[model samples]
Target chain A: MTTDDWVAIWLTAKLATLTTVLLLGLGTPLAWWLARTDSFWSRCVGALVTMPLVLPPTVLGFYLLLLMGSQGPVGQFTTWLGLGLLPFTFTGLLIASVIYSLPFTVQPLQQAFRAIGARPLEVAATLRASPYDTFFSVVLPLARPGLITAAVMSFAHTVGEFGVVLMIGGNIPGQTRVISVLLYDRVEALEYTQAHYLAAGMLVFSFVVLLGLHLLNRERRV
Target chain B: MKNLTLLAMPLLMTLAPNVHAAEVQLAVAANFAVPMQKIVAAFEQSTGHKVLLSSGATGKFYAQISQGAPFEVLLAADDETPRRLVQDGQAVAASQFTYAQGRLALWSAKQGVVDNAGAVLKTASFKHLAIANPKVAPYGVAATEAMIAMGVYSSMLPKLVQGESIAQAYQFVSTGNAELGFVALSQVYEHGRMRSGSGWVVPAQLHTPIKQDAVLLVRGRDNPAASALLGYLKTDAARAVMASYGYVH
Candidate 1:
């Protein structure tokens, strides 16, 4: 592969890692609240959170372009704060990726949190643990698998992000050009050998990771 | 009576589609989309051929054509792609011809931002200047060439934001994501005036002429609608629409 190809791969890795971290930080509270609450508000928010799952990336990208353009309210607010436009920057792509992969992070984490049940929290409370202590000591340990799943899914989804990035990303090298976008560029530039390398590498990488996870899960279970 | 006859031509043309109506799939360059749409509508009305128009970057179309895409004809943004297609044996060499002469423009969504002389590109006032991917789109190559001709290519390199196609480059300028951009003159032109925004049409001498070409693909062989569509492109009716959108030829 070319030097640009390596740069693209590295950029994608950074984007996915950062997106996973941000998703976990943001999604944890949202998923925690959704899991514990039985209010109608929970359902509404849950549905809203999962909306990205069904939304075509192009649609999200379109709305995001409008919302983040200079004439957009979000743009106006950012410009008011001296940040300028957000659509073509890496920060813009990160925001889009976080939104695009929110559900992928939240759903798994929510399910994990729900599976932990109230029993551990109740036991910890009976033992004179504070709410924070109970969550950190009991609930977290029980939800580790789900946490891993959420992080993995978020990272993977961000790595595969194409449409929204294509719509909003300006495709600057080492800034917003991820592997998928670079792969697209290579194909369009008629460098099929480079395209083949990127495509085959991604296929192999995804398969190995999945296989590793399966064996790890089996080992833990045994 | 002459004016009335001209008006009635379109009306009579609409009635011509019922007999021997057939569909032709076309892969058109994204830059030619607006003009191609008008041409398709006219062609359908006059020739009874239903055009399934698929528009995108010419590079993508070349890849698909090589892979045996179901497109009967290709209207490329660059003459090179059509010539390459013909060389690759994906298209008939004899069927290719220049369809339009594309013009590049320095444009900005904000009024008065882009002067007639296109001096804005030399200034560092604009944070991001958008252009289509130079490696893929012909208009992008022209934009870079224009910037180079002005001795501002190196200076403007850092501030550039590359769009996937000229349409998207126009979008970046239109949406004000980038303060200014290089885009197709046709995108901003209508009835001999810019539709919106301020623009400076780059002189043809600054860059290699973007000679957009149309060619029949191997897939189009034996398809009456495909040949008819190519024939329609050279007609006065279609040429008029092309001219209205700032295409030179």
Candidate 2:
């Protein structure tokens, strides 16, 4: 691969890593609330969080573009904060990735949290354990497998993202051009050899990641 | 029951001919979408054939065609792709011809952002300048050539944002995501003038000609409808539609 290809690979890795980290941070509490809450509002919020799952990525990207454009409300707020516009920048791409991959992170964590049930928390409460202490000490350890799955899934999804990035990121090299966009550009430029190489690399990477996840899950089950 | 069956037989026979109407799948470049829509309508009305247009970047269509996409014809924004397909034997060598000449323009949603001579490009006052990806869209290549000929490509490189197609490049400028962008004149031209925004039509001398070409794919070699549509594209009615959109035939 050329230096430009390496740059694209590095950028893709960075975008995936940052998006996974942010999703974990944001999805954790949201999943907790979703798992424990029984109110109608919780269901509404849950549905809202899962909307991206059903919506076409391009449609989501188009609205996001408008929302983060110069005339859009988010753009105005960012401009006020001296961040200019968010459509073509790395930070903008990160924000989009986090939203696009939210369900991938949240759903798995929610299932894990729900599987914990109420018995463990009740026992901890009887032991005079604080809610915060119980969560960090007991619940977190039990949710390890789910957390791993969530992290890996979100990371893989972010790495493979294309439509949203293309719509919002504008394919700026070294800034917004991730591996998928780079692969697309290679194909468009009729560099079939380069495109094939990148496509093969992605296929292998995705397989390895999914295989690892399945193995981990099997071990947890056993 | 025999009497009813006899009455329905003539109706069924008359409707049977409509089922034989040929469908031609056309892969059109994004820049030609506006004019192509009208041309397709006119062709359908006159010839009784259905035209299904899939518009996108010419490079993307070329890639798709190379991968064995089931398109009957390609209306491309550049001559090279059609010529390449012909040379590769994917398209009939004899059926490839220039359909239209695309005009490039520097456009901005806000008025007066682009001057008549496109001096604003030299000023470099905009924060972001959008253009179609040069590797994929011919107008993007022309835009780059124009900038290079104007001696500002190097300086303008940092501020550039590349869209995947001309349609998306127009989106960036129309939505104010970029201060100005390079798009096909057909996108902003209407009624012999620019419909919205300020624009400067890039001179032809600055870049190589954007000769849009059409080709009959090998898959459509035996389809009469495909050949008919190709011929129809050269008709005066179709040429008028193209000319209205600022395309030179």
Could you tell me which 10 consecutive residues in candidate 2 chain B have the lowest summed lDDT? Answer: B12-21
Give the DockQ (C-alpha) for candidate 2. Answer: 0.68
Residue A156 C-alpha lDDT in model 1 = 84
Single out the weakest 10-residue window by summed lDDT for candidate 1 chain A: A208-217
Q: Highest DockQ among the candidates is held by which one?
A: 1
Query: TM-score for model 1?
Result: 0.96
In model 1, pairs of residues that clash are none
The Cα error of candidate 1 at residue A116, in Å, is 1.3
Tell me the lDDT of candidate 2.
0.92
For model 1 the local lDDT of residue B218 reads: 93
For model 2, residues B1-249, the per-residue Cα lDDT tens digits are 999989998886566437656898999999999889999888776667798899999999988999999999999999999999998889999999999999999999988889999999888578899999998899999999999999999998999999999999999999999989999999999868898989999998999999999999999998878999999988899998888888886
Report lDDT (Cα) of residue B79, candidate 1. Answer: 93
Query: Model 1 Cα displacement at B167 (Å)?
Result: 1.0
